[model samples]
Target: MANHDTETTEKLEKFGKRLKELRKAKGYENYEQFAFKNNISRSQYGRYEKGQDIRFSSICKVLKALDVTFEEFFKGFD
Candidate 1:
């Protein structure tokens, strides 16, 4: 079970890093800027970008802001 937790954490962190890079590529400066535009808090956005095990609902909100699906967002990681 511990190993499973680690695997999930790794994936979450990878997702976070990927999200950060994509946002940067789109010309967003930082989590604060993205969050502001998306109407979320900077701290919350930072948590998602920094790996806090993002919830499905949060992902939905992010998808709306970034205009990308999870498949497309994660394809680069593959």
Candidate 2:
């Protein structure tokens, strides 16, 4: 059970880092700018970037705003 939890946490962290990288790649240095531009809540998006729990719908929204397909987002996934 503990191992499963740890694995989930690690995956979240990796996803968050990748998300941040994608945002930066899209020319968003400030998270606030990204959130505002993408119509996401700044604080909530911040939590997502910090590897906090987020809804799948929210993830989809973010990905859509980034112009990334689900396949592209999960590319190189473990």
Top TM-score: which candidate number? Answer: 2
Candidate 1: deviation at residue 1, Å? Answer: 17
Task: Score each candidate by Cα lDDT.
Answer: 0.82, 0.89
Instruction: Please provide, for model 1 over 1-78, each residue's C-alpha lDDT reduced to its tens digit, 9 standing for 90 to 100.
Output: 133477788888898898898789889988898899889878988988987767789888887788888788878664
Which is the leading candidate under lDDT? 2
Clashing pairs in 2: none
| TM-score versus the correct structure, for each prediction | 0.85, 0.92
Candidate 1 Cα outliers beyond 4 Å, as residue runs: 1-4, 76-78
Q: How well does candidate 2 score on lDDT at residue 21?
A: 93
